[model samples]
Every structure is written in structure tokens, then in C-alpha cells.
Target: MKMKVVCVGHRMPDWVDAGVDEFVRRMPRDLPLQIVEVKAEPRTQGKPVDALLDAERQRIEAAIPARARIVALDERGDDLSTVALAARLRRWRAEGDDVVLLIGGPDGLSPTLKSRAHELIRLSSLTLPHALARLLLAEALYRAFTVESNHPYHRE
Candidate 1:
């Protein structure tokens, strides 16, 4: 069974595009991967940051599939090792669950969206730029799949 990765984020730089393209190209053909990016709202003068985050959250929620397992990329989320992520991916595949990885905008995901996620994953303890986070996540997903299939791409 193929699992889908839905990444929701705002405007991304050219570097992000390049990184995503490279990772997607290197991914195994057997694994069906889809990336969904939600446009983030522009912050206006005097406009609260929370409002912008809320808008992005709405967009993300609307795009997510009803049956998919939602996982939010958040700083306060659980930190898992690469091998553990691979194991989780394998289990999800066996259980026929499509994975949806959510990437929030600058201010991060809204409380509602975060609560709705089946799991919240923190990529690192240090805060990372949203654009960089997306690329890193794509690579991590690729690595997880490679590990699951015992591919040489993932060392240790």
C-alpha cells in the first residue's frame, strides 16, 4: 500500500522547491508521494500573528483527508529517532493508513489543528525555518522508506 505525505505550508523560496524536487526524484517509484502546500496569509501592519496562523490552519484542515492519519510538525511534539520513524511508517503501511504530514506557517499551527493531529512530531529541539523544515521532512520521509525496504540509501 502506498502512503501519501501532505505537507501544508505558506510561500516557499526557490531553494525549497529545488530540495523537494530532488528528494521526490530520488524516492522509490513504488512509493506514491504527494505534496500539498497551502498558501499562507500575508501579515499586515498591526495584524496579530495568531490570526495569520489561524487562517493557514483553516486551509490546512480543509485540504487534509478525513481518513488519513494526521501528524503535525511542531516544536512541542514528540522527538523520534530515524529508526523509530521507519518502524512507524512500516506499521502504517501494514495497517493501510495514509499519512498526512502537516507543516504550519511562520507562527505555527493553530491549537485546534494541533489537537486534531494523531501525532505531533518535532524534527529538532532547535527552531528551524519553515522552508528548511519542509525539505528536511521530505528527506526524512525518503529515508524512512529506504530503511523500511533495507535500501542502501540509509546507512545505520
Candidate 2:
């Protein structure tokens, strides 16, 4: 059995892979995390924000695995602690369902996209840069795995 985590991020830099990889390497083979980048819609002059978001949303939807549960990361989403996330991960594992975590670009995900989310989560109350958000999310997933596996990497 394989556990897959697909992150549909908008425009993460090449260096972002390094940070994400660091945590991923710490995880066991039973859980494999993968980040897939979707092309971020360009912000052209005079173009409406809605259009950009819509385009991005389409790209994101296209990238998602049809059977996977969708988890949207948004400012207004529910905040979870490390332990809570671990429990959530445990549930997902027990259910034998893969998950796709969506991270929108500057304009953010469209309302239509958000409405389809199985879980809406917030990493923090403060607005985070796209780069930092990638790193944080990657690490959080690793921490969640550690918590579930009784690994020493995470502490209460």
C-alpha cells in the first residue's frame, strides 16, 4: 500500500524543493509525500483578479487525483495543532485515502474551488509568503507522520 500526498502549489521556486525534501526524507516509506506545481496564472495589467483566480483554479483541479480527498489551505480555514494533525493523518491512513493539499497563488483560490474542499486548514493566522508556506506545510506533514509513528523527531 502507498500513501501519497500531492500538493498543488502555485509557483514555488526551485530552492523550495530542498526544504521540503529534508522533512520527506525523515518520513517512513509507508508514507510518501509528493508536491506537484501548477502554473500560476499571470497577473497582467487591467485583467480582473477573478479571472486569474479562475484560471489557477482550473489548473489546480486538473492536477488533482480524481479519487483523492481535497484539503484547501486558506486564511479562514480551521487551525490545527501538531497533535491534531497527526490524528487527522491517522484517520486518513486508516481510511486508505490519498490527499491533495491545495495552495493558491496571490489572488487565492476561487470560491468554487474552496467549496469542493474536504478539509479547509490554516497553518497560521498571519499571511505567509508563497515560499515560506511551502516549507511550513512540508514540515508539518512530516511532523504529523512522526507523531503517528512514535518517532523522536516531534515532541509535545
Candidate 3:
């Protein structure tokens, strides 16, 4: 089963791109990881925030695979240990379904999207910028993979 990180924004800075690429390169081929950057909705003062979120929802939902297990990234979500993340990843892989991790934009995920997620996870308690969030997610997923395979990247 492949893992896909579905993000709202595209056109990351060079540094961010390099950082994400670095961790992604370390991911093993057995459970290949890929990134799908959906076009984020434009923020306009004229339109309600809900409207923008709805647009994002449509785009995100469209990108998701039918059987993919949705994992939403939220600040208020459960914070898991590296080992726990490894366990979840291993379990998802064993289920033989694609795992799709969702990353919302600056305004965050809408209630509709949140409600549809199979799980929600918070990478850090502190607020992080979108660019850093993607980098951290890439690193964490890579770490989870390493932990699952006993690669020594995560040490208790």
C-alpha cells in the first residue's frame, strides 16, 4: 500500500522542497510515499471562509483515492509517539489500502473534512507554517517507516 501526503498548497520554497525531498528519498519502495499538492482556494475578504473551505474540500476529496484511509492533520488532534505512529503505519499497510494524509491550509481544515477523516494527528503543539508542516510530515512518515522496518532511525 502506498502512502500519499495530500496538501492544499503548491509552489513551496526551494529550501522546503529540498527538505521534503531529503526525507522522501529515505522512504523504502515497499510502501512507497508520494505527495499530491492540491490547488488551494484563494482567500478573499469578499467571500465567506466557509465558501473557501468548501472549495478546498471539493478539491481535496477529489484527489483522494476511493479506498484511501484519510488522516487529517490538525493542531487539536491526538499527538502520538514515534512508535505509535509506526504501529499505525504498519497496520494501515497491512490492511492493503492507500493511506492519504491531509494537510490543510492557513485557515485549517473545514468541519466537513474533519468529520470524514478516519483519524486526526497533530505533529506538534506549537503552530507551524505550512511549509514547515509539510517538511515535518515528510520526516515523521519517513521515521515511521524506518521504525517499522527496524532501520534504527527512531531510538527509544
Error of 1 at 62 (Å): 1.7
Supply candidate 2's per-residue lDDT for 69.
80
Best by lDDT: 3
Per-model TM-score versus the true fold:
0.90, 0.91, 0.96
In candidate 3, what are the lDDT values of residues 1-156, reduced to their tens digit? Answer: 989999999999999999999988888888788888989898877988899889999999998999889999998898998899999998998899899999998789889999999999999999999999999999999999889888977888
Worst 10 residues of 1 by lDDT: 1-10
Tens-place lDDT per residue, model 1, 30-135, is: 6766778888778789888888878888788787876888888889898989999898888878878777888887788888888998999999998898888888
What is the Å distance of residue 64 in model 1 from its true position? 0.6
Off by over 4 Å in 1: 1-11
Cα deviation at 138, candidate 1, in Å, is 0.4
lDDT of 3: 0.91
RMSD to native, candidate 1: 1.8
Each model's RMSD to truth, in Å?
1.8, 1.9, 0.9
